[model samples]
Target: MTDAFRFFLTLLDLAGLILLVLYFVQMGLAAVLPARRLRFPAPAALKFTFVIPALNEGLVIGATVETLRALAPEAQVVVVDDASDDDTGRVVQALAAQDSGVSLLRRTLPQARQGKGLALNWAVQQLLNRLRIDGADLTREIFVIVDADGRITPELLGEASSAFADGRVMGAQARVRIRPSVLSLAPRTLSGRMLEQQQDMEFFIIRHLQHLRQRWHSVGLFGNGQFMRASYVHEQFRQGRLAWPDCLLEDFASGVEMRLAAPDHRMIFLDSAVTQQGLPDLRRFIRQRARWTQGAMQCLGYLPRLWSAGMPWLARLDLSYFILGPWLNAVIVLSLLTQPFRWAFGAHGLILDPLVSALITGVNVVLQLQWVARYQREHRLNTGQVLFTLVSLPVYGFALLLSLPLAYWNHFSGRRTWDKSSRHVEPGEAVPSMNGD
Candidate 1:
């Protein structure tokens, strides 16, 4: 029995070493390979339609409206109030009454918070109805999706429009980060503040990697701050495929569909275009990410399509690795942690022995620190914050690693309800939008 267990442990170690090496190699290639040179035309005088799908978001709705209005006074803002029993609809209705550019689409029971996908679909129909009445040209406009507590600056509008000038690119995703008030954090709320900074670093790393994937002309949309060409979205909605994604992670599923719907249709990641979001409670964060994992797992249904020769091999390989992440994470964590026990029990030649694990951990941290040093100007992490984040890597990483198992539990238990993320955007929590390097 002991020998059998040791053999399994050795197998896990081998898997972990392979995954670790593959991960770093891919990241290195992405970092070192010179970006493909493709010049986009200058930013057009593009009109934008901002869609905010809200459910009981009264606290932050008004501020969201004000910030967006400040950024683009001429852009059309549509607030889809999904039957919030609170004053969410009322707040937006008043704003719509006051501002000519702002419009409110109030939805009641039988169609409320059914899911964000359906709520967004409802808003799209209303937008289409409004546009048809006004004789607006869909081809000349862009559709931007923003969360209720998210903020965007006007500068991103022009930069994103320039990306869409290629005509082949269907979507553009902005770099998203969390920037809660550091000074206003009370002793009890310090954990939340710390978590927010960690999230900011996470976004910085993810956005940079996605930017690298652009060299292969392969990119995907994020849930918040997704900008799409209006004509394509309009056609999809007309065909009834754009809105009714069955997965709880509608944003991710929609992104995959966009990639598979046509080879010419592609998304781009814009590091320069940035969006700031506030962190929810830690408990809600787990629920949110578990849903994300399941959503990603659900996208496994699209594997056959992604593997088709129609898609680029680079994108196909990336998707396969991403889908295997949940399982690999468990192997990686166990292999790294159990090496000492295995060695003490007469195990030998393990791929992830204690020394090797330490080496891997050291290199990973050094790479992360390099990212911090390069973008410290944009992230604004202090000495204490940096130290705390360095120490907290395991905690943050384990949090995601656990999600794979949680997703399995959700699937096996037949619990597929969408638990909306709790919103707590207090006065000081809304971060002012800024441009990224």
Candidate 2:
């Protein structure tokens, strides 16, 4: 092998190992990080406005609005029917007619369906306008963004209320959980069932990392169940800023902007979660993740601002690592592709020894099992379900591995739009309880 090529291989291996070590370090931190305690306001003390951006979510929108109304009967539920070609607007309007708390903001063709961010911005402006006219305290109003498939409980709002009790907190992300019932109700083959469970397992890991991020006060939004204060939203709007950036990952971008906009402002992680419907099949899962990966790539431009934002160093590091995650995967792709060439040329690959590589893989598997075990215990899964989850990890990892490149391909090929997930569950299906009862 050429000396220059050999040196490049060595660098790739080293970088790959470094990234692996960082993952383990984060896993350790997640294991030990304690939840933050804060003084929370009473439920009646503050107003909550739920902004749900619906785009052809006819199957799930009605159920979602009903759940929110039941959980927070006093809270304002604004459903922005983003020109859905279905009955989304009609469903929400019927609910609005029944309950004054439920309302719909119907958008027409040109303005609607542009992006989730635009839909959110339009809804927030309407709320702000009414609140301003009513002479209400904008700071005391909490705006939550819910997906049409979101199933949240009282705990989600309770945790958010506690976080916002600390005046410095302007944003809070409710932990995300994949609804198991979605899997049971949907007709699926064995592989499809496993794929759905894998998606749920992936969410379990995400929730764990969110806990660790709390230590750095760098919690981020999941787009489905994130909350923001009206005062903060108004401030951004007043400065001619989009409350939520018009991007694929508007939720993530908005979180980063919140941090950069004010050094003292914080985003907290909620202990409770907002359960979302699971992906019924592999195609939807990959498409969803690829969209997220591409969106993360889109967020890389904020790294410069993040560094100079005067936030805590750990917070900056954590956020930067997240935004740059896809780029790191690009390195992994190169390392894998060059392994055959390295072996043919009698040079070392990414990992020098076969046994060592096997050992590393084993360790990763054990760690994954530990995470799965915790999830099993928390959700009270049966042994078969636990085994199913364990078996699903490889499939899950493979899907993620595939998604990074797919995302890169899409980003460069100018294919930014994605297919939204289709729902099969009937509206009458019971919304699963928070504790998995």
Candidate 3:
């Protein structure tokens, strides 16, 4: 074996070891970090306007509206139907008629306008205009944006409203729980578990790190349930030039803009405010992840601006993490694949002993289990759902690997489209059983 090949294998092994250690460390942090309780204000005197952007959500629209009605009866609820081919409009109209607080708005996309960002911009514009005409104070009205598939308990809304009362808090992000579904294929089951791991890590670990640095500015805004001050959003819209910036990742771009424009405006991740949403089936899940990867790469230019714009050390670190994390995964995978070839051809047999590698792998498994247990407990996931995580790791790893090239290709080719995911439920219907899969 050549010395060069041996050196390369050694480097690869070291890199893998480091990543393995980091993964465990991240999991440990997630497990032991004391949960922060958001101080929500009394809801009696506060006014909230819930804004939902629906594009073919006829199935889930009714249930969401009803949930909101039960949770925030006094608050105004506006449903923006984004020219759905389905009966989304009719459902909202019926719901509006039944509940006076519920208002319906139909947005016919003009020739040039496209994407959820556009739909959101139109709805928010209408909201601002209505409030202005009504002579309502901008600072007093809370605006909540929920995804069409979003399921919220009554307590979630109240908790979100309470966070708004903090004055400095410009936005509050709710905890996202992926409702588990049964899948026949092992790959599909693994993919779902990987997603569950991501959610747990985001809420428990990543979010804490963000808060500690005072730069916890962004959340899963791709309509992961969030509430913001109407006035703040309006101000951002005007300053940002384009309403949603013609970007595939509108939520992320908006977060960057908000942080830059208002440094002190805190965005809280309300642990108690939970939203139940579906995980994509294996195929759609890959597509969704590819879109995110592409979007993140395209927005790399914004990182320096975010960093230089008076963000705290922790916030800056978080930004760097996202910008480089995907590539790091790619590197780790490549290193793992090439290690054996190098060992056979090179002088260095293996830098790390098999026992050490096994120990590292075992640690990784334990950390994953800890996260899965915490996630299942908090979200009330069933035993089958909990077991799915254990089964999905390799499948997710493969998906991650496949998504890298596709994301880069789309980025350079300038292929940005509103690749919307389909909703699985109908208005007022129970969540579909995963067992059918």
Candidate 4:
């Protein structure tokens, strides 16, 4: 082979090797990580206040409230109703009347301060004041933040509270399960599997690595079912406006801020603390992904400060990957398409080496299968869902590519609003309890 051809082959080989390493590392982590189980200390005295920030969640608010009541009867559940045109507030109010543990705090947005973050900030302020006036012990009160659509189980809450018993831990993130749907097409199914793969890698491998290094920087917060030290949250908010008002990916931004503000604090992933929410339909799923991709790129605004402050290498890598992965995949696909032209124009070989392409493609297929089987086994998803994921790989790749431009557009336009996901509750369907991580 000529020098140019040799260099191309070498590059392909390196990419294949890196991809294989990532796949096996994920598999090893999945196998080795223990299943998360919440174990509370005797006489669970620590108090928890659940915060549900809702924006036009009229349809699912009642179900969420009912689930919370069942899971944490002793804990206070506060519903922060962001200005909704629908009957969300009415629903919350009705539930609050029926259950004393439930309380409603309604906030109408000023034209200037309209955003999920602002509403969350308002709620946090109220919660802080309540804790202060009641003389609640800082160490004993935990603030649990759940989304309007979030469904929690009894065991999940139990596990979260147990984590609070460890005084050094600042927060705990729950395992979030996206519900499977029979209506899923190839793209949607593959997209769901990819999301699961990302979560499994983050929760099992990346998190463990961070913990082992003892340079635990908040990577990303699982928004729906996470518990935090109330005092810590209050202190951060007091320093500046710290809520999920206008963020497309508020959970991630909050996690980054929490890590920056408190280097000593530790956040644990409760593999057991579980919450379930409906998967988005194809269009909404693409939009939601685009928002995340854009938010991740926007997080680059913090890179300079993070680097200057001497952030850990792993943390920096984590953030970089979030910002680059989608775009990189797009570039890789484009490069493959242009390969024949490059070879025809030049003196080098015309096509990607068949062996190299076959090896890489085979590895990719195996990795996807491994993840699908693992997720199916662990979650007990129906065989149809598993098969759906297998068929959707190509469609998922296209959707990811589609997200690149959307991400860029949203970031520049300063339109970081939360888009509500479609609900998927069926009559007589058994709801699984939340696992406390």
Candidate 5:
């Protein structure tokens, strides 16, 4: 092998090991912390505005709006109909007429569903207009962004409100999960449960990282159940940066944007605020993950700002690792895919050394085991489910994970189209609790 090529392989192996070490370190801290679980103080008194952005969400929009109404009667529910071809607009408009707390915002076709960032920016403007006319305090108000299919409990909502009690916590993300009843529902198959459990296990690890990251006051935001400080969000809207690049990962951009916009503030993870996220079938999961993976890549735009974000060194390091996660995952997958070819053709040295390859693989196994431990301690997963995850990990884990490469390829090839998740939630049906992850 050429000296330069050999150096490249060595460097790649070293970087992979460093990231794995950091990953274990963070998970270890999350594991050993005395106050690991989420706990909440009394709910706080704050004006809340719910912004539900819908694009052809007729299936679940009605139930989502109604649930929020019952959960927070005093909160304003703003439904942004993103030029839906379905009845999403009509249902929300009808509800608005019947209830003063609910309102509707309609957009034209060319603009609607162009991106959620645009829809959310419109809602933020409408909210500002309302606050001005009503003479409310923008700084003290809270803005909650829930997905069209989001199922949040009243308790989670209360905890979300209380998370901003400190005033410096600019954003809070909830622990998101798929409903447990899905396992017993119709058309349930081993593959479907595997898919759901894979995602659930992922959230288990992600929420723990966020919890650890929050100790340094550098938590990131998840879209479905994040609460943002009203003043901070308005500032972003006025700056014309509310939604970045057709709303590429709006939740993620919000966290980075908040840090740059408000130097005095920090973000948090509200483990107590759980949002029951509805999962699509296996076919749909691919499309959804493609968008998410691409969005993570697009968020690299915020990396420059993060360097000067004035956060602690640890927070900056954690955020940097997160920002590069998609690329790192892509590289690792590429390395693994090339190994077989190199092994057969006698160019094995072009890939990782055997010892290094085993080490990298071992790191992944240990992380999976750590996730199992976390699910046991937190989600109270039984042995059967844990075993299922171990077996299913190879399928659901790699399939979703390997999409990072596809996401990068699409972006570089100038493909940025987004497919909205199809809503399938039944009205008034019981959504299993998240118990704050």
Candidate 6:
């Protein structure tokens, strides 16, 4: 039994080692490889339609609409109010009445609040119909999805349009940054500040990884700040496979499908950013991340299609690794949980030798420090914030680790409803969960 446990520990160590090596190799390649180039068309020539999904987002939806309209006056903004019992619909309707470019799609009871994917899909259909009536060139039109709390700079639409100039590119995801003002709502404490900084750090790392993935043609969408071509969306609509309403991570599932749909299909990571409000508290953060984790696990259904997509082996490998992450984490968690038993049975030796463990630890620390350095440089963080971030990263990591087991439990227990996050709920108020996705 002792030998068996040792073998299990050894296997876990090897799996973790392989994952670490893969991460290093990808990061190295991304750093050394030339940037994936694309042609930029005049921003004036591109027609953008921004789709914002709202569910009881009365507080911020007005600002989001106003910001997008201010940034791109010529662009059409469509806000789909998913049966918000609040003034969400009225707020958007007022905006629509004030500007011809703004429109509101109100979903009623029974069909409302299904999922974000369905809301987006419904908005696209309405957009296509309106465009068709105007005899618009669908092929040249771009559809951008923005969350209700999302804000984009003036350069966002223009920068995003640059990718579509490359005929091969079908989708583009803008870099996502957490807005600092939202964190003001959190209690004034070191932990609260750490939460905000760590979220910023998380998005920065995500952007960097997306840049790395551009080489592998495996870039993903974050729901907010995601852009897709209208013609491609039209094609999906006609084929009855537009947006996935059931997947918890509808954005990710749609991304995978986009890649598999065509050989030349490419998704780029945009240099422009869309700033979003972060969860002000840990409870909301965990709920949001658990939903994301479960969504990734649900995406395992795409494995058969992914393997047969005829992508290069490396791309397939990268994607497979991503979709299979929950299972891998589960194994690692099992290893951690069983360590006490191994110690009890006198079978607790180092999974890797002290020297090897130290090397891995050093490499991880260096890589993380590199990320922090980049974040600090890009965001102009002071020394104190940098040091605080470095210290709090482990806590953030442990928080993410906690989400995985909860996600797995929820998945197995058939808890698939969407638990909406509230930015201004009072002390003990429960965030509401809606039907369907």
Of candidates 4 and 1, the better by lDDT: 1
TM-scores for every candidate against the unseen true structure: 0.88, 0.92, 0.81, 0.78, 0.88, 0.92
Instruction: Tell me the tens digit of each residue's lDDT in model 3 across 300-335.
Output: 777778767886766666666666666666667677
- Which ranking of candidates, highest TM-score first? 2, 6, 1, 5, 3, 4
The clash numbers for all candidates, in the given order, read 0, 0, 5, 18, 0, 0
lDDT for 142 (candidate 6): 90
TM match of model 5 to true structure: 0.88
Candidate 6, poorest ten consecutive residues by summed lDDT: 428-437
Could you give candidate 5's per-residue lDDT for residues 1-437 as a string of tens digits?
56665566666666666767777777778766644454455566788888888898876777788988988888888888888887788778778889999888888867666788777887678778878788888877888888887767767766766677766677778877766435553445667667777787778777777778877767888888888878777676677766323556877877777777766786767665555554547767877887887888887877887887677878778777777888887657766776775566545333557897788678668767877876777767688767776887788866786566667777789787767777665545653222311
State the lDDT of candidate 2 residue by residue for 1-437, as single tens digits.
Answer: 77888788889989999899898788867766665565565543678999998888877787889889899887889999888887778778778998999999989988777888888999889989999999999888999999998978787777777668778889988878777544352345666677767777777778878877877878888888899999999999999999798778899999998988888898887778788887766777788888889888888899999887788999999999999999998989988888788778898744558898887788777787788888888889999888777777777778778777789999999876744566656435753322323
What range of 10 consecutive residues in model 4 has the weakest lDDT sum?
428-437
User: Relative to the true structure, how large is the alpha-carbon lDDT of every model?
Assistant: 0.74, 0.82, 0.67, 0.65, 0.74, 0.80
lDDT of 4 by residue, 1-437 (tens): 37876567556545645645664564455445554443555534688888988877776777888888887788888998878776778888877888899999988756322655666777878888987998988778888888887777668766766667767677777766554343433644555555543433334343444333233354357577767787778777777747442466677676666666655666667656455554434566677678777666666666665666556677765655554555554445544655676677663332467897797678667766765676577668687656655656566567656766777677678776655555555335544322211
Query: Which pairs of residues collide in model 3?
Result: 41-162, 59-425, 59-426, 59-427, 190-392
Candidate 4 runs further than 4 Å off: 1-44, 111-113, 181-219, 241-246, 310-312, 323-330, 333-353, 380-386, 422-425, 429-437
Would you list the clashing residue pairs of candidate 6? Answer: none
lDDT of 3: 0.67
Error of 4 at 370 (Å): 1.7
Clashing pairs in 5: none
Model 1 bad stretches (over 4 Å): 2-4, 33-37, 182-187, 330-358, 380-382, 402-404, 428-437
Candidate 6 stretches greater than 4 Å from native: 28-34, 40-44, 182-188, 424-437
- Structure candidate 1, residue pairs in collision: none
